[model samples]
Target: MSLLFRRPTLTRLLLLKNIKQNQRSTICSKPPKEKIGPVQSTFALCVFAVTLLAPAGWIMHHIPEYRRQGQNTST
Candidate 1:
């Protein structure tokens, strides 16, 4: 039917207009200008290291199969 065809075109135009408006608002907004202090930066680095390393440490400690597979591959 003509209604079905026109409905999707109308929906598409509305979605496009909404997206353009959002893009314009973001473009007009100013980004924050801030620098991380040394203490905060160090804490962030420690958090990042723990997040990155803790899982690997847990897997190494608990998963003997991974170690066996590595040994097999290396030898």
Candidate 2:
């Protein structure tokens, strides 16, 4: 309880110390050596779309089945 209720000044000091010591990292400063082709970009986009939408599509497709099961179980 004492630790949880410690003075605000101490917390502020700790936060300031952390902020001063924090280091930022960049992913990359240079551009890619090779550019991605349009075909490869389109394929990548399609794969990404399928990855994201396949599960939702599966769930939506089976929603009626799920509802029927729920009704049968409740009765």
In the order shown, what is each candidate's alpha-carbon RMSD? 6.9, 5.3
lDDT of 2 at 3: 86
TM-score of each: 0.43, 0.60
Q: Estimate the lDDT of model 2.
A: 0.90
Write one digit per residue (lDDT tens) for candidate 1, span 1-75. 677565567888999999999988877566668877899989999999999999999987978888788899998
Candidate 2: RMSD to truth: 5.3
Best by lDDT: 2
Candidate 2 lDDT tens digits, 12-50: 999988877674333457889999999999999999999
Model 1 whole-model lDDT (C-alpha atoms): 0.87
lDDT of each: 0.87, 0.90
Which portions of model 2 miss their true places by more than 4 Å? 1-28
